[model samples]
Target: MTTSESRDEAVGSGDVDFDHHSLTFRDHPHEALAELRSRGPVLHSSAHDGFWVLTDYASVFEAAKDDARFSSAESVGIPASGMPFPILPIESDPPQTQQLRAITMTPFSPGTVKSLQPDMREIATELIDAFIERGECDLVQELTTPLPARLMLRMLGFDESTWRSWVERVHLVIHDRAHDLDAAMTAAGSLLTELGTEMERRREAAPTSDLYARIVHGSVDGVPLDDVQITMYGFLMMLGGMDTTSGLTSNSLLQLCVQPNLRQRLIDDRSLLPAATEEFLRHDTPTLGLARTVTEDATMAGQSLKAGERALLMWAGANRDPAVFENPDEIDFDRENKRHLAFGVGKHRCLGSNLAREMFKVMIDEILTRLPDFRLAGEPVRFSDAGEVHALRHLPVIFTPGPRRK
Candidate 1:
């Protein structure tokens, strides 16, 4: 159908020409999101070629779980990335999605992630030591960004020295996509080249424990994955492993910088860090949300949607619904039902959740113990647009100069 027809069918209550990537939305999403949610559970936005916005807990939850009617096969980004290859598992529906997910499941599995904690802690320590005696640092560049990238490289058997390049490429694609589509596409192409080259190398070598080797030799129903499929797997892994965790960690640290009491509380009782992590995730929601296509003519949140229409499941909105969580705007570590949709929900839930959580706790623990007096040296710089991933580009912080722990 034409874009006009799509808009016509989407006309209903709660209608607004909402653009999640808009400057207004990025600068003040909480206020904008609250206004959107107050309109109704679902609203039609004549943005990104026209799509419905699922703004409440029930509607977002229902749509996310019932993927049959609300499909992910078409695209997950509001304005699609326009990549040459499909983003596995996330951008695909069932069967193929499940198969692709299974191939990478082992590396991101809870058990596997748990085993990497010591290394995670060591990386955090080494990163802190790099600038501990300097009295100040940019947390995003010095710590958050590299920690995940280095870990991912270690898992893929790639040299960790190239972590900065990997981080830049992934960040360019994710944080720059909204404003600079061409740059994002170019970064994606570069990523594909690097990943493709590595996959080729793995193909000629004997299978091993690294994630690259696994994907290179992996199969679906006994059929070996093609080079394109392997590259896509690598692409997805790089994005998943690097971006969201850094965003979540950096956002949480920003909170501590602004809320001294919160920092002191966590320092006093480190156990509270885990609960605080959940609350931070619920409030900050690094991933914001993902997009889905209406598979068949369906009614959701009392709104009519036609097949091929797009709907954005706003996790950030759903996580703050008053009906579900008390004082939804406030961060409550004591929240009993911390079942927030930060990592998302249902079949497409984040596979790296365990690792992300562990990484967050470890980073927070190290920071609190060593740089307990750290405070913001300047305003944190958020990404230009946060439609796909909510992130900070810089977090300048200062503390009493200390000796390098390592």
Candidate 2:
């Protein structure tokens, strides 16, 4: 049989069609991955134009570190989107990636995130007040969506009024691909154009600590980033920070909605929230795994891969590998090794993880304290194509009224 037919049969000869970019994994990622892992360590998927899926932790982490062999110099899109411009350090290889990463690191430093905590809490509280007395609200629409957008505004020195526009447009660009590709690209183009204008504006103004100023004035190898590079960096910040965290918040909250028992567990012991956070990240990671290109022909987990090929380092799959975690499907916050590949592994690890963690902690804490009894008001909506971003489009919840905090 040809490789295409074999890949089609890779998941038990027609029993289940497993494609990394298909609605199958997006809707049933755990179930589908459990089946794939049972087959072997790696399987070729015809999804998103055919790519390799890394099914185990060992394989994913190893390939992540071994960039020379599984290089990230080209488009990292699982199906390889052939992006016109690089997403800065993420698309750059080795030495150059290092330099670009350095220029982008200072703004997301731990200290910076710590200083932003008060702002984070304030944002969460303000969001709760908007619909707290209504006895029901779509958590994704009311809180999760706006939280990241507003935070990004504050972090990057954008006008607070534009937060809603930014949030709506960014969500469309990243998560609406399945329903509307033209709209997604249009949203992306608008964001990039706005970013270019913002970058130029910041450059002409006084330097500040916000990411915009840093990127506009920040130098790489003692040279300022050119228009394309600066704009790309800004684009990455908006893309990387906004929708991913929004989805993470929505996904984690959905678990709380469905698993009432888990909610009580968190309520009983708030300290476990940190552990719970890690567990949620492990089980229902929001963003899809980034793409890595194959530098040369190689064999991984008994699968023969050719040079110039792309491999999706699927973190969502690896974190659930039973070989690595005992009772892989179950959520155990007490697991000794809480280190999941949620933020990814290796040099390309998430730069803004600290910011993300703080947002999750603050958002969840606010929800539990204010609306402990919130339950699903309606069915949650998810994306049609789980290829790029695994997120909820809508999540409605019902709860009793609570006094708004000043």
* Number of the top-ranking candidate, with lDDT as the measure: 1
Clashes of 2: 0
Give Cα-based local distance difference scores for all models. 0.87, 0.79
> Model 1, range 1-406, lDDT digits (tens) per residue?
1212233454755579789888778888877878888888889888878888888898889888887878887779988878877787688877777887788788888899999999998899899999999999999999998998899899999999999999988989988887889999999999999998898788787777898888888898899988888888789889999889999999889989888999999999998988999999999889888999887776665567888888999999999999898999887788899899998888888878988998988888989998999999999999888898888999999999889876
| Highest-TM-score candidate | 1
Per-candidate TM equals: 0.96, 0.93
Provide the lDDT at 66 for model 1. Answer: 80
Candidate 2 — which pairs collide?
none
Native-to-model Cα distance after best TM-score fit, residue 287 in candidate 2, in Å: 1.9
* Model 2 residue 25 lDDT score: 70
| Model 2 TM-score, 2 decimals | 0.93
Clashing pairs in 1: none
